[model samples]
Target: MARATTAHQLHDLGLAAWFGGTLANAVALNKAAAHSGDAASTGAVANEGWDRWTPVNAAAIGAHLIGSVGLLKHDLGRMSVQKGVGSMALAKTAVTIGALGVTAYSRVLGRKVSQHHAVPAADGTTPTASTPPDVAAAQKKLKQLQWAVPALTGAIVAIASYASEQYRPEEVHRGMLQRVLP
Candidate 1:
């Protein structure tokens, strides 16, 4: 029979999954918007993406709440061995770093693209200083994405590390399986 899981274990697992899924969705949407250069789409995506965090963060907080209540209850259950938590954490770190780098690249691209484009001011005169509203809006979202993606990626690492430690203590325990299997 499996040992009982500490409340902390469940919380980490839930948060890791939530953060990972959220980051993936945001990154995918941002990529699509970047490709299409659609301001409405980008802005809408940004709005939805950013808004998702309100509830998600709340859920994570709720996990903490549940964890705190663990004192009132007996053991819930032992966390299963999550095979890929360590790999997932490492992968997440790489992705996050890449996302940050992409942010810089995106900003440079936006500036260059804006230089070739023009936007109409309130007077309807095209401003040489900026791109059109649609283009500008899209760029603005990209700018936000540049920072957001990497930040989210980092969160994935943090979440993964927390989850992995609880589910896979083997690396710390240094199981005899390492000796036998090798």
Candidate 2:
């Protein structure tokens, strides 16, 4: 296989690891919530969920963006187009749709989480990962930050789709054709 293929495969693997890792972290957070009763600690699961998810979405968006571009590059000309039609086309369409769907879903979830409210701690302090706040305002802020994942992911998906459209092989090749042939 070509180096590019190897790189793509590695990138995909990284994404899979991150997604799985994020979910695992979420699970761990739930367990922590179950085991602990400290007011500062009760919602740690949601907190960690917010933390882990941000990077997960960011990584996912990056991977999809790159993948779309890669596919577009592979889709130019007669032989390539022939390979892309049928099952390949279906697969491509699925990926595009899935990215958009996930991005939208993530955004919605992020918004919901952000809107959630919590009581302020008796002591004034910004909630840190180490000191999970017992208060509502802090909880709300944490929830908003949790969406870093989805927002980043959506941004990535949006950018990749744009790149795929812009760098489409035919478009890239058109410029080449004019330069070379004319």
> Could you say which candidate leads in TM-score?
2
Cα TM-score of candidate 1:
0.36
lDDT of 1 by residue, 38-79 (tens): 443443443454445546644654663464345114322221
Residue 30 of model 2, lDDT score: 34
Error of 2 at 171 (Å): 28
**Model 2 ranges with Cα > 4 A deviation:** 1-3, 25-27, 38-40, 75-86, 114-182
The local distance difference test score of each candidate is: 0.45, 0.46
Residue 57's lDDT in candidate 2: 61
**How many backbone clashes does every candidate have?**
0, 5
Where does candidate 2 have its weakest 10-residue lDDT segment?
117-126
